[model samples]
Target: MTTTVPRTANSADTRGWSRWAAALILPIGPAAVAVLRYVLPYDTVDDSATMVSKVVAAPGRMSLVLWLGFIAVLTLVPAAYSVGRVTRQRAPRLTMVALLLLIPGYLSLGWLTAEDQFLWSGAKAGMDAGAITRLADAMHPSAAVAGVFFVLGHVLGTILLGIALWRTRVVARWAALAVIVSQPIHFIAAVIIANHPLDLFGWGLQAVGFAAVGWAILKLPNDKWA
Candidate 1:
């Protein structure tokens, strides 16, 4: 009689490795944001003219920083989904809600990048700062709507995800709490006060929280990860 080998073991091993890869990717978004905040030249208070001037002065550096922000936003989608997946066991409803909001919120970041590109291109073309600022200031209604979605979705969704993580008790309490408060601190720093240091701290908190969760995920056995 010929012996047959089962494929189940190999399939499971593949899935387990995928989970490990995801866990490794989870903290990258927040860490990139932290680094971007540290290196970014303009604050929220800086007008388009000021921003364009900065970009003109250091086009290569500004391009790299903008690309970093773009990468951070893109990676955050998977990171958010992973958080929802891990937390679903204990807080299914909360995870569902958070993902619904967070996914779109993260996606909306692509729209916001258009303005940055416009600024960069204008500077590259040797357009006057005041002219660039004027054009940049003229926002369409759709852009405004997307901006609102990005703000509300990321802020509220992250907080809800933090709550879900807390309920699960998968990660440390401090990690969950850091996730909960990071976004509000970011809003206050970026919008209200326009403080670069505070923005750095906010992103730092997010990085710490995600890093802790990533560590916890790494420790989980393959059977438990799903």
Candidate 2:
């Protein structure tokens, strides 16, 4: 016998909002981050002063990325919640672990972006290159370690999330596969292509993954899953 669970009025309302939030945030967040990367100066992992100079050269444009990118990352909270709900039945444990990894991954990225503004201000103030170099060198160790963890969290979280969604059959399997593949592709592309506008292709793959998840969420009927 098949027993169907009934959704309450409040539950229905929450699901509706969650679906909409997922639909909007999933695509928008990655799109914003990709656009920012395309518009900003090419990124170099080791060149702090050069980065600061680029941003300080056009503080206004940098501010657009700084603020908008932060907002886009914040949207990950809702996106995570939606994912948890989607994978609750078949892969609850995996989803939980993925969320744990994702929180710190996004946080490290966000903190670094905010920290860059401080560097920008120093550059704008005509600080001596020697002083800036000393500061950058001093910060390098901790930053490098955090950067490693950031990459680990993102790659691991992506794999776990994709596997969970795929195993549960809650979303399209191809979409889950895309989400899994996008991470490593983005990293390799960033390395090989370095700082070209073509990097958008790598980032766009991430957006496609998110868009697929969002579409999957939207396709769920009101009474489908809690």
Candidate 3:
């Protein structure tokens, strides 16, 4: 097969950097969000609100510009690079799903923060009074719905991602295989308790899928530069 047809159109490529970024993305992203979240205020959001506001605080507004901007840049550049490289590998379906979830999921900030960004129960919950007042002025009812979609996208996407990680050639393949087998089993458990107080455990299953993908990309073999 011609290099352009599949392997790589340009061995003289930046794919290495792209994969490296993907590997680091999971760990760095949350930390970055945590920092951004810190800058927003926690009061004023009511216990009865149904949406997250983009301007819950100035820091949140700025962080969205920074982190969401980062997300957009990464998606256009690294994600594009990862497309054929990761997707055409031995296991493609799951990897592709993972990527799809990750890229758009970042935008789901609206969904994830709804509980407090616009509806903080108290100052101890999220940001300060000024931020909450700002958010309330701009908050909308759709933010919660947006958040739900975001979480669902991530949750459903994990099944495919877990499969892809299990296929990475990093640790002989047996370890990957073990993870692959275990994910589906655990996934069932998560789905079973998807309601009531047990839903929290379901999240744990999802986190595994997150970690596995991170490891796969981190361990992904990039011989384009070697």
Report the number of the highest-TM-score candidate.
1
Clashes of each: 0, 0, 6
TM-score of each: 0.91, 0.80, 0.45
Task: Estimate, for each residue in 16-120, the C-alpha lDDT of model 1 and write its tens digit.
Answer: 776777778788887777777666767767877788788778777667768877888778999998888789988999999999999998888788767777877
Sorted by lDDT (best first), the order is 1, 2, 3
Q: Write the per-residue lDDT of candidate 3 for residues 1-226, one digit (tens) a residue.
A: 6565556656657767866766555434333333333333322232323223333333445445355435433432343224325444666666666667755655565455544433434333666656655555565767766655555554454445445655555333443444344334433433443231222233333333334445666665676323
Candidate 2's C-alpha runs over 4 A off are: 1-12, 140-145, 192-195
How many backbone clashes are present in model 2?
A: 0
User: Between the candidate structures 1 and 3, which one is better when assessed by TM-score?
Assistant: 1
Candidate 2 lDDT, 67-184, residue by residue in tens: 7678767875566567767886788789999988876776677756756666656666888766765676677566776677667877788778878878987767777787777667
Q: Candidate 1, which segments miss by more than 4 Å at Cα?
A: 1-4
Model 3: CA > 4 A from native: 1-12, 30-88, 110-139, 167-221, 224-226
Clashing pairs in 1: none
Candidate number with the higher lDDT (1 or 3): 1
